[model samples]
Target: MQTIQTDVAIIGAGSAGLPAYRAAKAAGVSALLIEGGPHGTTCARVGCMPSKLLIAAAEAAHAAAHTAPFGVHVDGVIRIDGREVMQRVKSERDRLVGFVIDSVNSIPSGDKLSGYARFIDNGLLEVGGHTLVRARSIVIATGSSPVIPPQYRALGDRAIVNDDVFEWSDLPRKIAVVGAGVIGIELGQALAHLGVDVTVIGARGRVGPLTDPVIKAYAEQTFRKSFRFEARATVESVVREGDEVHIGFRNEAGALIHDTFDYVLVTAGRKPNFDRLALENTSLVLDDQGVPVYDPLTLQAGKHPVFIAGDANGVLPLLHEAADEGRAAGANAARFPHVTPLIRRAPISVLFSDPGIAMVGARHGDLKPGTFATGEVSFEDQGRSRVMLKNTGLMHVYVDRQSRQFLGAEWIGPDAEHIAHLLAWALQMKLTVDTMLEMPFYHPVVEEGLRTALRNAVAALQAAELQAA
Candidate 1:
């Protein structure tokens, strides 16, 4: 067997792994990066880029069809060509994927290895069948894989996941989407707008990762206008029937729902790819969920030289979070003998469903009721929303009642993603509610809605103080 040595060894070449490799290099550490699959990052290949491409196409189609309300009628019918749409999505997805692949390729050939890496022992990794790597410290960023339920496996090709959905040359006429989380909602709504009959099933009564009740309710209301939602639903079984797939589920009322569709797309959730890593060879002890115990701030796995980051940690699965974790883990691994604490960014998440849904910083449930006050503004009458004819949801901001500090925010409204980022930055800087209100909000813009919400929060706090006095 071939033997190699390095200061740091990074497993997986996805979003997190690449950043870790770069950071380790920047830290002047000798690093070896390994991957068993394609070099392109997950976000560029399957998760974010391709998904957004489909959403963009769907948005264009929806815009053209709905322009009649704006007194702008198309001279000809606006028809969706599934083949052309998929082609365009694939063409652009490949370009982005190629860019990531090129970046990975730019690494020195001697420092890059292509194979499945398994831990044979602490500080040692066996690659593929022939090579062994010994490193002082290692970073695990193997990423995650889609969770395919056992019941759906028997249905064969009819059961699709996000990894398979983007590759299809033609979309199914009807699809039953399991798990109305971020992936499910975004793809489901986009497919529905593109003329695919879609039914989204959520195990809970919520869609997306919405924790705020106000935003969840408004998001569900708006989403219902685009497609069918079977919340509090569970898939009992799935069977292939000739050309179609028949799915059996129990609805919220416990009523049996049997439907036949062209395909069943599973977006239930994702689990970290730890099985192949042979982590048992290390001193790390995995918890009940098979995730290694580690410090969230340092990303260290126990007191050992091993570190876990990105989706592999199973903490925050968003792309930006993964990137940040990768950088921290890489730097820490490079500086192995001495550890430095890193402050994580405030949590920010967004679901790209029309009238986008977003949450930033602390969730509503995370805040103490008496300590915090909420401010809200509905987009139903917002000036910008009315002008754009995209008014549909609401924004809720949470603030500390006594300190007037902005705690967090959740919004289901037009351009909530952009507004969420602004809130995230403010929270990161520890900005106060009063300070945010003082920020300029251009007239007839979505940001004005945020200003209104912050103002309302201030007013609510004043009311509470007056009652106490």
Candidate 2:
């Protein structure tokens, strides 16, 4: 068995692990990065990049088909070649994955270990069966994997997960999507637009990461138009019948429903990948869900030299959050024994569905009614939305009633991702509602919709003050 020594050892080389390795090296610490899976991060391979590529193709096909509304009639029928689409998506996805792989290869061959790492003892790790890594500090950034229920697993090849969905050379003509979260909704809608008969089922009545009731309602209305959606649904069973899969579920009203499809895609959620890491060998204590209890600010695991970052922390699963957490964890790990406090970025989440959904900072339910005021604008008739023919959905901004500080926002509208970033930056900078309202809003732009929501928040606050007096 080969023995290796390093100042810091990073497990998983995905989004978080890579950054941690770089940060530790930048801190003048000898770092060893170990990865068991493919070199490309989840985002580049199966999560974000390929999904968006599929969505973009779906959007183009949908747009070409709907050009009649713009008085641009096509003489021939527009078609989507599923095989070609998937092939192109794979080609481009591989290109992006290659970049990350190249970056990993650039590291000294001796410093990179290609294997699964398990904790043997504090600051000691066993890699793949051969190499033993002894380090002063460790960073666990193993990330997460899709959660597959026993029922779905029983169906085997009949049911697919996000990872399998992207690799398919040809998509089924009809499919059932379980769990109306980010993955389900995005892929469900895109598939529907791409000429597939898609039915989406959600255990909860809401879709995406929506917590704001107003935004949730708007999202439901907007998305239901593109695909068949059933919420508050409970899957009873899944069975394979010849070439198709039959799914049984109970609707919100207690009515049993059954459907047969070419395939079933499960996107319930993701679980941390630390189960294989033998964390018990370390001093870290895991919660009931098998997540390490760590400080969000420092990403440290208790008082030990071990640190947790990215999806492994099970806090925020977004790509950007994972990267930031990795950097902090690496820096802290490199500087262990002499700790430095770090502040994490404000939370931001986006679902890349048409009339996208985004949540920035505090959610609507998190705010106390009387202490916080809300402002809203409906995109149903917003100029830009109307011009783009996506004139549906709403935007809501929450502010502190007294200080009028921007607390957070949730929206379902055209370019919600971009709009959410604007609000995220404002909230991070502690911009007040008044200052946001005073900023100039461009004409015929989606930002005007945000400006209107800010104005509404201010008005609501003033009205509340009048009522109190």
Candidate 3:
């Protein structure tokens, strides 16, 4: 058996782990990066990058097919080549992954370790079967994996996850997408636009991460026109047929629906990769979900010299959050007893469905009633959206009734992704509705829609104040 020692050891060389290793090294500590899987981060490999590539292709196809409203007409049918689309997605995805691989390759060979790491005890780790590692501090950034329910697992090759989609030689004829979360909605819509028979089945009334009822309802309505969507599905059974996956569920009309698809794409959500890390051997306390109890600011696991970051924390699964958490966790691990807390960025989430959905800061469910004011706008008559012929939109902005400060927003609109960032910045700066209203709004722009929502919030707040007085 080989023995290796380091000041800080980072398990999993994905997005979070890579940043952690870098931050520790930047802090002038001996850092070692260990990985049991491939080098490319989730974003590069099967996540944001590849998914966006597919969406881009879908957008192109959709635009070509729907240009008649803009007085533009295609001479013939716009054909989407499934094999070509998958080829480009995989090719560009590989390029992005290659960049990440280059970054990992830059690390000195001595500072890198190969193999899965398990905690032998606090401050001690056994990696693979050949090496024993001893470190003063450990950073767990083990990313996450797709959770396949046992019923779906029995479908074998007939059932696939989001990662499996990127590997397709060609798109399937028909696919049943389970879970209408971010991944499911984005991929389901994209696949539908690409001429695939896609059915999006979601439990509960969830549509992406939307909590605002109006926005959620508006989003659900908009997507139903594009694909078969069953929000709050009554599931019967998910079993395998001869060469296909059979899905049985009750539709919105309470009609029993039996369908067979080339694959059952389960987007049930991802489980953080800490379950196999032997966390029970450590002194850190585990939550009901078996995740380490850690400080959000410092990322310290209990009082031990261990830190948790990325999807392993199961707090925010976004790439940007993972990177930020990784840097914070690594620095804390490198500094050990002198760990410092970091002020995190305001929360932001966006789903890349046509007429995208965005959520920022506090959710509607998180806000207490009467404590906040809600403002809304619809893009059906918005100038730029009308010009672009993408008038399907609904937006809701919220502000603290007492403080008049911007609280958060949930919206579905044309270019909602861009709007969400603006709202996130406002939330972080703690800007008031009046102050936001004072900001510049160029005439005939999508951002003008945001200003209208902010104004509505101010009026609503005033009305509430008047009612109280």
Write down the lDDT of every candidate, Cα atoms only. Answer: 0.90, 0.89, 0.92
Error of 2 at 456 (Å): 0.9
> Which model is ahead, 1 or 3, in terms of lDDT?
3
The parts of candidate 3 lying over 4 Å away from their true place are none
Instruction: Please give the distance, in angstroms, between residue 347's alpha carbon in candidate 2 and its true position after superposition.
Output: 2.0
Instruction: Report the number of clashing residue pairs per model.
Output: 0, 0, 0
For model 2, state the Cα shift of residue 93 in Å: 0.3
Q: List the residue pairs that clash in candidate 2.
A: none
Worst 10 residues of 2 by lDDT: 338-347
- Tell me, by lDDT, which candidate is best: 3
Off by over 4 Å in 2: none
What is the Cα root-mean-square deviation between model 1 and the actual structure? 1.1
Residue-pair clashes, model 2 = 0
Q: Model 2, residue 83: displacement in angstroms?
A: 1.0
